[model samples]
Target: MSPATAVVLCALAWTVFLGAHLALNGRWWPWLAVSLLPPPLFAAAPLALLLAAAASGSVPGAVLAAGCLLAGWRQSGVNSRAVRRSSPERAGIRVVSWNTQHWNQGREPDRFYAFLHSLPADIYLLQEYLNGFEGGEVWDIDDEERLRREFPGHHLSVDNNSVTLSRFPPAGPPVPVGACSLRVDVRTPDGILSTYNVHIPVQLTVMNPLSRAFFQDMRRRHGARRREYDALVADLLANPHPFLVSGDFNTSAAIGDIRRMPRAAHDAIGANRSLFPASWHARWRLRLWRIDWVFTSAGVRAEQYTFRDPGGLSDHLAQDVTITTTAIEEMNR
Candidate 1:
């Protein structure tokens, strides 16, 4: 192929790949199924294309490739490179958020429990508190007794599929949010904090993309995902106390759902420093997608944030965050 022709193909390839993530992104039908793939895969396509074109020594192709990358970067999700640390004297609450896929049933139960014991978090927001899928069918799991026995000091709040075990006593009973999420008002040393443990439904299951069933299921799942996001957004708006929300949102940095959150909401990961800090599909060393997140309202600040490897126990990494009150006015009633 001619060098010029090769460059054009490379640019077009990148354009289509970037367009999918920028435009489709699980927001619509058939294309929604395509979006299930990690967005980083799309974001990285331009880089690969750029290298191929540049190797051809085609200046225009290299320039066009660079432009595509810039566009991808602009639309890419938030990531922070700068580490924010708290003052030694400042008291911060350590919150650990994790989606224990099928709980301990899928892994060695003792090791799973031991991993949980190692985290020195004040509050634990856990999801997928259900039994492992058996031949594609999932059943409820009753681990409340075991959880209580394992973590003696914390109070447990169990909603549908998520659990909130807090060392801080409950200020009130757990509020009904939705089937995929749980909210609890807890009394903290700083003040009453509204904490949400969420597990938003995935957009689509892996299947034959060209099949009619795939699109149909994608549409149904999209609708369900929207309703869940709407419920969570509504609660976040009406909540009066300083809040923290953490979970498997089943959303990427590129999705509109996370953007639908309150304008004042701050990411627990702090300011955007890195481009892709993925937390799911742990087997992939690159960790292409960040489906799990930790977000806090205006009054709260995340002093430290980190994602812990689950040691093949689950598909997602655990989010460990240290949050402190930024303003007395916001935390106090």
Candidate 2:
């Protein structure tokens, strides 16, 4: 094929690929298209297309590459090349949200727990945080008696699939509602901090099954998750305290309007306008999707946002967030 023709095909291919991510969800044919394209192909196809086209001496290749890069950069949301760092302007409260995938005491227990202890976070809220309290005893890190020895005096609540470990006491116990959400209010020196930790499972077992039943189930899961998000937003609105909602959203942040994530809250990750740090796997261990998220309400803003490397145990990368009191007067109240 002529270089010109090849470049044109390449541009069209990249355009279609980008369009698919923006438009498709777990429905029918589009679902297949979106899911079938593996994460590697999703990330690399456009780059490959651009390079092959540029080598072909086709001017269109440059234009297509520019468009492709621009689109990607926008989706990435990163403004500056340098990652933002913690600042004193922030309220001196460091919060880390992680979906530990229940591996705080797995193969690398020492490393995991050590890393956990090292974070300077005043609070650590986790999803998929499991520590059974069956025998009239509360346990963390696999119920080791040492937990009491190690954490001493630090407040911890590990109930439901969601957990919160903080320096100060939360106003009450976690409120679990809908299918997979936990709400809590932390009484910080600044004010009451309303926080919600949500986990929206993607129904992986039925997502790709050939049976029509599974296909229908996939759609229902989407509908159900949508409702859960709506209800969570409503709850966040009713909260009297300064608030933030962080979670394993399951769906991509690029689908913002569909998720209808709170307009009043600033999506901390997006608000930082930082680089795309994939929170989920693409292959044996490749990071590809930034599904884990953090959002803060009007009076609060993130001073810095950073993530841990994907620990071998969990599919998610832990997010360390430093939030500031944008409205000092409100926080004083």
Candidate 3:
């Protein structure tokens, strides 16, 4: 094929991607697809260069490249100022949330133990941590006993897929909110701090092959997740203390409902950091996406945020957010 023909083909493909990016961020329902397949927009620069090289006066290609550039910047969170390395005073609380990929036995126990020891978070919220407990809906006592003996003084979900490990003991037993959400308040210097760690079901897949069943599945999953979001938010909001709702939402911030946190909570990473931190890997560190999140109340300010090793043990990346509520207390003082 001629270089011009190749450039023409690349330009067409780039145009389609550019259009998809623009359409995906729209408030309309179709934009939901963008939330799932966000990484494709990154191809804009290379394609634009190819187009420009093949044809010096390629107006359509130029426009497509420009749009792609704009979208890429926004998606990359270039303007995000939410993440930092350390807290303003280093006295803020550090919270870590990771989907530990079921903490499969013997998968990466040595590394996992090292991670647990090295994590600086005062509070740890882990999802998909399993202990091989499966028998007639009964939690395996052996598994539960092992974790209790190893990591005692924490409220854990044996049946569900989430766990909350705090430096301080829970004020009381964990209160069940719903399917995979539990609330546990801890005593802090400022006051009581409540955390609702949830594991929501996965959202509609955009990468799936396009078919009638795809649309139906998307709608079904979206509807179910929407209800769960509403319910989880309501339950968390009704509780006492300045709270944070965190864990894997399985939905990207590109979705309206996903962006709408319970009680107007702020996304610690999204608000403070401007860089796109994809938190999940599909196959062998490929197909990355940010489905895990941490949301804090207005009173709690996230001073810093960072992602754990992407290619680490779990398919999901760990989210470490160092936050301070001292600002609120200081203001009150």
- How much lDDT does candidate 2 score? 0.64
TM-score between model 2 and native: 0.72
Q: Which tens-of-lDDT digit does each residue in 236-321 have in candidate 1?
A: 88888889999999888666567667775677665323446778887667676788988888778877777889888888999888
Instruction: Compute the lDDT for candidate 1.
Output: 0.78
Model number with the top lDDT: 1
For model 3, residues 120-186, the per-residue Cα lDDT tens digits are: 5678887765544321132222255555565665545443556777876677777766666667787
Q: How much lDDT does each candidate structure score? A: 0.78, 0.64, 0.63
Candidate achieving the largest TM-score: 1
Candidate 1 stretches with Cα past 4 Å from truth are 1-9, 16-21, 48-67, 74-91, 106-108, 271-276, 283-286, 330-333
Instruction: For residues 131-151, write the lDDT of model 2, one tens digit per residue.
Output: 432222334444434444556
On the 0 to 100 scale, the lDDT of residue 40 in model 1 is 59
Q: What residue pairs clash in candidate 2, if any at all?
A: none
Q: Give the TM-score of candidate 3.
A: 0.70
Clashing pairs in 1: 79-272, 79-273, 79-274, 80-272, 80-273, 81-273
Worst 10 residues of 3 by lDDT: 133-142
